[model samples]
Target chain A: MKLHEYQSKNIFSKYGIPIPKGRVATTAQEAKQIAEELGGRVVVKSQVLVGGRGKAGGVKLAKDAAEAEQLATQILSMEIKGLPVRKVLVDEASAIDQEIYFAITDDRASKKPVLIASAAGGVDIEEVAAKTPEKIIKAYIDPLLGLREYQARDVAVAIDLPRDYWKDFTKIAMGLWEVYKNTDASLAEINPLVITKDKKLIALDGKMMIDDNALFRQPDLAEMRDTDEDAPAEIEARKYGLSFIKLDGDIGCMVNGAGLAMTSMDVIKLFGGEPANFLDVGGGADSKKVAAAMRIILTDQNVKAVLFNIFGGITRCDEVARGILVAMDEVKPSVPMVVRLVGTNAEEGRKLLENANMITAETLADAAKKSVEAAKKGK
Target chain B: MSILVDKNTRLIVQGITGNEGLFHTTQMAAYGTNVVGGVTPGKGGEWVLDGKIPVFDSVKSAKDATDANATIIFVPARFAPDAMFEAADAGIPLIICITEGVVIHDMMRVRNYLDQKKVRLIGPNCPGLLTPGEAKVGIIPGDIAIPGNVGVVSRSGTLTYEVLYAMKNLGMGASTCVGIGGDPVNGTNFIDVLEMFEHDPKTEKVNMIGEIGGNEEEKAADFIAAKMTKPVASFIAGQTAPPGKRMGHAGAIIEGGAGTAADKIKALEAAGVKVAKHPEEIPTLL
Candidate 1:
């Protein structure tokens, strides 16, 4: 999950990495208070979990407390890239001498955690990578052995960093690695790790993305999840252990596995129908879980028709059929539903749903065609 | 006749006392997989499945007693890494992990550890291997396949079943089906299974099922173009999925304009492999 800039900086501070003195402000008045505490010269950054905040005018410099409040008011009322700026970070402005780009993320090709660093900073790393490939340096770290001091020093030297700053660079690198490892972060970034006029290094901007699968152990990090960034139906679906992504269309897709769920969506569009959402009830879902998925799908008003595609392996079609029946009794949904049950106990499942006032098909192609027609008729 | 599991395969179940373990163990045994002993900590000397299969306290004891050549793990994600380590240490040549949601870091460590050993790990989140009508290791339904010359390798479970069901309707079956899993950092990849299928003489043709994530499919296409002489068909899912939104699977995300269905299809077609536009079309292409 993506953490806001302020939250990431807080984690960085906890790891002994230096960050500008700041706090998150939810309103203009709070911004003035934080700016005054930081001695009036500050940078107000939007707390949205997206990029190009500067291009969207969500970031501004304030010369004093009054200007800080004025800019905060402007940013608070602004919406960048369709996401409203609900909070801003007011940080003490510092004198910068140089900048560096640094991050640690899993390199899928190597199947290991890699530390990426460059002398170029405060810009799009992808752009730099495309422009000057030699500027980008990477070091792969074994998960068992972890990042070593020599490796960090080599990165520092590769960036042509002066010897005097090697110790501070190594410390920050080690601290960032700890933050990444301890928080189970898929990515930990420090863009523009600036060296101040006094020669102290401080993280000017930070971002951390935690692994969703590791959240069970990192409870503290999990609790920092920003609920406002997620849809309510999505949060509800998570509670039921179902993976659902709402989309803009009329056909609601419910399938047994992730790959099949996506394939079902593709087939719907191939048959000239747009899917309203992608929902997977998982490999071993029971009747209750299936009912929950049905409710979640019906919650979207755009769904004029629902498609139930089950190719049961660990999941039995009979149980999924029973789940649809249970949900039908509770929700009393009016939209048409096309059910295609295959695999284990498929015959029993088909028999149970024969008289349930739903359309039935034998193959995915047939199901898609029927659902598209049903959705068009419903429209 | 199969690449991984076959009639000669003697299998043991880890976490056999758990609900999923006991259930799939019964299914595998019913499919004619030689039922060796099981491993459940503190359940040593106990017997499950109506006193037919013995339960040992550890993989070592079970391996020593049954001389099991292969083992399937149903342990939860938290302890799954340790389970793989134990199986590797016990010298099991083939280890198939059916557990899902294992942390990527843990799997990275497990992958590194298994690299030095003479073991093949299938998945940390996958639906095991199936050698139609002969033996089954993991949770691929025993009834969906029949003995044939086609070798299937997929990154999905139910989608694989969808393709295989269509192939079966068209009078085609599998030599063996392998689910390399959906996690970003799994032990096995498309190339590993593709290489195996390319070498198996009993398998004449291959069908690859990939989704919209990673460059594994593109890499496999290159492997097919450069090395394999057998005919290969391909299907790439999630053409309609939006970028940046994970489509159910952890690895099924299109980020930064890469790992898209369009890219995978282009790569496969450029390699002379018939790319199926739909899941049901795989059999026709093959």
Candidate 2:
């Protein structure tokens, strides 16, 4: 789950990492009030999840309260990267002495949390890595030992941070690490850990992405989920423990596993058909869950047909078939349907679906071919 | 002779009293796995499955009583790390975790601890390894796979079955199939299992099932090119997956324009591993 800029900064502040004095404003009037409190000079940043908000004109500088209100109204009315600006963070502007990039993320290759720092900051870090390459410095934290004081100091030195700021840098880095570990965040970043003209270090911007699996333990972070970013059908699917991703296509796919679900979509594309969405009913799904998944799929008007690909192992084919039957009763789906059930009581599953007016295939190839044809005819 | 488990392997079950644990335990036992004992913390000194499998309180006690060399976990994600540490502390050489949704931090610690212990760990959110006709460990269905020369390794559960079923249809079977799990941080990876398969004499050609996210496939492609003599075929899912979407699997995401199916496929093809265009094409490529 990606945390918006203001939300991330709020978390940073809680950890004693200095951030520009700011409050999230949902309206132009609110932005004006915040600007007035901050002595009239502020930056209104769009609180969207996507990157490149500055390039999209979602970020603007306002010299006075009136200008802040105008900029907020403009931003709030605009959409950046297809996401509307629902909230804007009106932050007290600061004079920059220098900028440095800092972040801690899971390094998949090392299977450990890695701290990344650079002398260059503010711009896209990936772009900098792709261009300069040598400016980036990294340190891998031992999950058992955690980020040691020496490691933080080393990163500070490697990033060419002046010796005067080492103490504050280490403190901020440690605090950031605490926030990351406590929040179960996959990424905790400060794009520009800027040194102000007054020699004070503050985080200019913040971004955090919490680990979804860890949300079970981190209830507070889970509540921060922005529902506006997800499609309604995708959100509904999650309630039933289903993993659903909506795509633009016609064939609705319901499969048991993530891998199988993607493959079902891939095969659909290969067979000259498009998958409307990706839905994984998960292993050992009951009839109720199956019915929920079917309803979620049918909610998409682009779905010209529906396909069920069951390669049951722990998930019994017969159980999935019962799910399809139960779903058929409730949804009464008008779209063409194709069903392929294989492994573990597949005969029983196929038999159960025999009279459901659904096209049944013996293999995935056969199923894809049939589903493509069905979708075409439906179209 | 399979890469991970065979007839001689003795296994213990953690979280044996849970619904998933109990159900898959019976499935594994019915498939002829030597399920020596079980651990359920408080439910020790009891018996389950008609008193055929003894239950113990801790992994240490279970190991001492059953002399079980391997354990498969069905514990919830919250306590899975403790279960792994318990099994490792008991000096169990092989630990297979079938539990899913384990926190990445916990798994990272588990991975670090297991590495120091020199214990071979597989899955934490995976369908465990199946040595066909010899030992069926986790949740992979026993009927779909038969004893044969092809060794299959995948990052998915049902997708592995799809590949195995397709292989079975072509009169081919697996020596063993390993599900490495879809979590970002996992115990055994494609390279770890592929190395085992390469050494196993029963294995001839290898079938690899991969998806987007992580450079494990690229790394495996390098390993196969540099080391392995056996022919390998691979299929990478999510070829058309949109960038930045976590296509169901936690590890299966394209971040910063990296870990894409196209990149993985390109690397694998350059390494002489035939990249299958579809799931059914995997067996034919092999």
Candidate 3:
């Protein structure tokens, strides 16, 4: 659940955070029109959901409307980090006196939302934290108390900001926190919170990633998801209540739990086979969901072999076997298949699949080794 | 001698009238857990599962009736946090939440309340722990566990089962196995379980299963080096996981170079723990 920069800025504006006026443009003419209205000088940014767009040449500064249109034309037709530039933000460029980095993310160790701010801005903050270390300051906001005035001041002072801008910095920080809390955002960041020549602060770039588990209450935020930003198989997998991530290799992994699915992938690699994709049917997955999962995995042409490694606790092996039987009839996949069934009703499930032309393994290690050999043979 | 639940763990199932609640409750009782009763709000005064278990309206009433010291949740996400808070208030010392998708914000509040009350919460998204042949709680299969001295702690559901199966394959049975859940924030962590295993008399060796996400594994490595005297073997998943893309679990992601499997492996190995390159290597390493 990642939001594009323009989308993030839209949410930021609602919280009273200052942002440069910008409009999303699908075509170069729209970008030029927005640039002309903003007095010609503007930054054309690709609205992809990945970082390093500037390094990938998806971000460009134009001196005037003519250059804005040319840059937009170049950016709109290009791809950055495998994401196409379907839309670009034409934003008014401002003169910056200084830049600062600011963000709010969940700290797993503390189990609280932490505010990370630094005086050094407009670059990779992780790099800064790794290199300088002391320049970056993190403040954990108490959930009940929230970002207190003193806590906000700690970040500002730690960044070595002038006393005159402390109050304004606190206001922006609070606003950012509001956006994060209200949107159910896992992460909310504003890189290069710039100080203009006149001493007014504005967020030059914005990013927000909403927690998927909290989407039930945040319907409005959920609607902002761009399916175009996701792979088609991934989108299809979600509809069936299955979690899927496409990978490069020959073996397709289908497991029940998230941890098991990752282990299935890792074991494949360890056994000298690369995983084509990661798929978790999730607990309580029924026959229909299992069929849907197989259908989605079969659509991956890179997958030459399919492995079913299930530890059926909440997810019964019998139900999974039934689903595979149903899928085998529908998909009729030509690739080799290997399965290792264990736990509840595994004997019945294995009985159901015994007639199918699939190799069965006694252990996960055997399953991985067999799947690798079968996949390589198929290749 | 188990780390958490054992032969004495009397259990209450929250949302007991629901489908998952009834299923696992029946299984837990069959596995010899003293599943006393259950709570399903309006379904009080009724009997479920062929009238073998009593049903109460709230955790307090259930506790009063069953003398239940522990409770496991099977409620939906919307009511999970409230069920947890109610169980804590009802004086249940051990709370095992099997309900996945509990809101992160709700967890924060529940965690704070649990800290004040000195309660042990495990897995809002986890498979509850098992103490081999003695007691079973949550959803881990009872048949695979064999009574032995190995202690296992994991952040994953299926991977824990895989590791336990591996140990069982090599004639190494477990004392107890705990899945702390795969969410970014959980009720318990690796260090907590490791510390418990360090002191447990029945446990001889320890197995840790970690994946991508926060630096918890790295921190746990430091804890093992500083406090733990028992031999520890570890395995980390998601070495091929792409950076910035979450691999299924909310917490399993390679972000900011902190949660990479390589970094965690390097840290854990530096702490004198035998790090398994694969699951099959774990039993040998230990």
Largest DockQ belongs to which candidate? 1
Candidate 2 vs 3: which has more lDDT? 2
Q: Which segments of candidate 1 are over 4 A away from where they belong?
A: none
In angstroms and one decimal each, the interface RMSD of every candidate reads 0.9, 1.1, 1.3
Candidate achieving the largest lDDT: 1
Q: Mind giving the per-residue lDDT tens digits that candidate 3 earns over A1-379?
A: 8999999999999999999998999999999999999999999999998889998999999999999999999999998877788999999999999999999987777888899999888867778888999888899987656778788888898999999999999999999989988887889999989999989999999999998888889999889999998899999998887899898888998999987888888889888999998899998889999999999999989888999999989888999999999999999999999998998789999999999989999888899999999999987
**Residue-wise lDDT of candidate 2 within A208-306, one digit each (tens)?**
999888888888888999999888887888888899999989999999989999988899899899999888898778888998999999988899999
Model 3: per-residue Cα lDDT over B158-239, one tens digit each: 7888888778878989989998999877889999999999999999989999998888899999999999999999998887
Off by over 4 Å in 3: none
Native contacts matched by each model: 0.74, 0.74, 0.60
Worst 10 residues of 1 chain A by lDDT: A121-130
Arranged by DockQ with the best first, the candidates are: 1, 2, 3
Off by over 4 Å in 2: none
lDDT, candidate 1, B110-172, per-residue tens: 888888796899987888899998898888878878889999999998999888888888889
Q: CA lDDT, every prediction?
A: 0.92, 0.91, 0.90
